[model samples]
Target chain A: MTNASAQAASPPWDDVSITVIRRDMLRFARMQLRDSGAAEDMVQEALMAAMTSAKSFAGRSAFKTWMFAILRNKIVDHIRASSREICGADLAGSSDMDAGLEEFDVLFNRRGLWNPDDRPATWADPEASFEQDAFWTVFDLCMNKLPEHIARVYTMRELLELDTAEICAELGITRSNCFVILHRARLGLRECLENRWFQGEAR
Target chain B: MKMMNCKDATQLMSERYERTLSLRELLSLKVHTAMCKGCSNYGQHLDVLRQASARLRAGNTSGEP
Candidate 1:
């Protein structure tokens, strides 16, 4: 073994506290479930699972990473169970965030060229805005404003950092369609941020 | 390969996050962004948006909305 690997201390997973991460876990669950009651149940189950499997944790990852991994697996299962009950109806409709197409039309013509007027102007002081808490608030609001299904897809792909195949299997979307949905989500988010945060108050 | 316009370039820019681009797509995006100021500006906006998203998540772990 290398000297660095031998010297590196393993995190004390045994003393890890679940209470500390409870709120963050709940917030993440609520974002995915949009239902507080279900979110609570999921969090409870995740904590229980973590406790049971604490001995199995080899400390290769941080305590928080291990905990959240359990929580995310619970979420994936929850999404799967809920979609199953709906008989593929919701998952079938998952990929259709095409309502944002009109916004795309405003930016691009039938020939796929960006409209001259719609070209983004130089954003004023964008880097500085990242330091402001209020900017993140507006950014959060804009993200929440995305259509429910599309927002979920974006959340799964971007926030959860799930791979495309996992997302496709969980959401029942084909790869090509999944890419289109994510693209539209980014476009919609970009426009919303432009209107509400970037150009709105930054100017 | 079709002539990439500003619209296609912007879409490709976003897709770069989710998947690998074809060589043709990359070359097209390169040529298009090289000449199109609008697409280039959009690309920069995307970079800021990505950074903002990362910062937002970082703050979230501390329990802020």
Candidate 2:
């Protein structure tokens, strides 16, 4: 089919190509900001930016991927601008991870322990109880509870679809350190979710 | 079979699972996991968590959340 004919045949937003991706972008924004209003704003901003800069897309990657990249950059910009006061030191130094790690070390050491191995294992069958809204609510709560640095790294890498190398460069961390941060973030989230959603259900 | 320490296994299996490890590192992890129930279980848990998170995120996007 001709490109025009194909384009005409597809619904503007219902087109399978962009529909799910757009939704994912919105969901990611919500998860990252933990505010539906801000998330919707980010989605609209990303959509506008993508549409205006369509020519710059280059088509080297999927359109959704490109759109996500734009959204991620926008999110980072929003976060930076919004936290200007708290992250002034982070903004001044190129190495956010180093500064973040130092802060984490102090906090973590003060807590007198890193691992929560003493806590009971609490695994749930996602297949049965995996309602989306509830999951994200729990997920968001867990993510928000994480240390700021770990959460930032985890969000950028997983939710924003950034490469580890890019995250390392942006956060001024080595690949190994990035993985360590991510691992800790994941472990913490797992425990949090288990306690809040899974185990709580039993009680 | 012996079990890998949680700390070391967490590090090794994480990189291995992400496909970010070098061949040598990957081989070492494979060897370690071969005899390590704890590492194996950790890997399983990580995989489950990843899938569950992705599904949850996708569900939210589709308005099921």
Candidate 3:
């Protein structure tokens, strides 16, 4: 990622380190664009852009966040250029697949109450450091564990901050479908984080 | 208000993020969660996850690695 016209300073990529997070950037791009080829191009563009601005990244913020911000802008810009009409074909994991929802059934009893054994335990004051890299790893792991369709919808709803109508339009799904996907995404994520992060801490 | 089961209440809690609840659904959820410890804790966890997700994206802009 070197530039011939650049100064004597080493490229900030060594500090920013794309090698590790390249997969993450690609995954996020794939989720947004749903086309691996386009996702690859987007990541390439973002990486090139980040390289252009490498000198400014004097470690002012977390490298991954800065890089992701650039990638997200590139992806969002690409989406805007294409708009809703063209996005339907290269969609992420198909939505109607139930997204591993059978696992959730075991959380409740035949009476539709939370089973005593599966009841959620209280997570006490853990507000201090969840944003740290360790916790973000847990978060990422839990997120990755979710089925793609669930993750795709949740990313639209939460990460992209799309509303019901917008998400419905983007995914070409009905409001009910969007809601069900979001519901299962949240349930799965909440349970995963509780077990992997909170309960792990408790133990 | 028609009483709802914990499963129904949990579904409503998640659905609220996508759409505003009808008055009856809202009341049912409130009443059910009020009396149900497990569901109440579940709601709190949901809230935490919501906030975390919002922050995740928002942090991208502010550059929280």
Clashes of each: 0, 1, 0
| B61: Cα error in model 2, Å | 4.3
Q: Residue A172: error of model 3 in Å?
A: 1.8
Q: Please tell me the TM-score of chain B in candidate 3 relative to the true structure's chain B.
A: 0.79
- Tens digits of lDDT, candidate 2, B1-65: 34334555556766654556777666766776677554555577677667755653443334354
Q: Write the number of the candidate with greater DockQ, choosing between 2 and 3.
A: 3
lDDT of 2 at B19: 59
Instruction: State in Å the error of residue A110, model 3.
Output: 1.2
TM-score each candidate: 0.74, 0.63, 0.72
Would you list the C-alpha lDDT of every candidate in the order shown?
0.71, 0.63, 0.72
Candidate 1 Cα outliers beyond 4 Å, as residue runs: A1-20, A51-60, A93-103, A109-111, A115-118, A121-132, A200-203, B47-65
Fraction of reference contacts reproduced per prediction?
A: 0.44, 0.23, 0.54
Error of 1 at A202 (Å): 5.1
1 or 2, which is superior by TM-score? 1
TM-score of candidate 2 against the unseen true structure: 0.63
Which candidate's TM-score is highest?
Answer: 1
State which docking tier applies to candidate 2: acceptable
Model 3 DockQ reads 0.40
Model 1 residue pairs with clashes: none
- Best of the two (1, 3) by TM-score: 1
Per residue, candidate 1 scores C-alpha lDDT tens digits across B1-65 of 57888777888998898778999899999999999887887888878767764543332444222
Tens-place lDDT per residue, model 1, A88-171, is: 656575334355545556778778887665667678887677666576666667777777777788877765667889887776
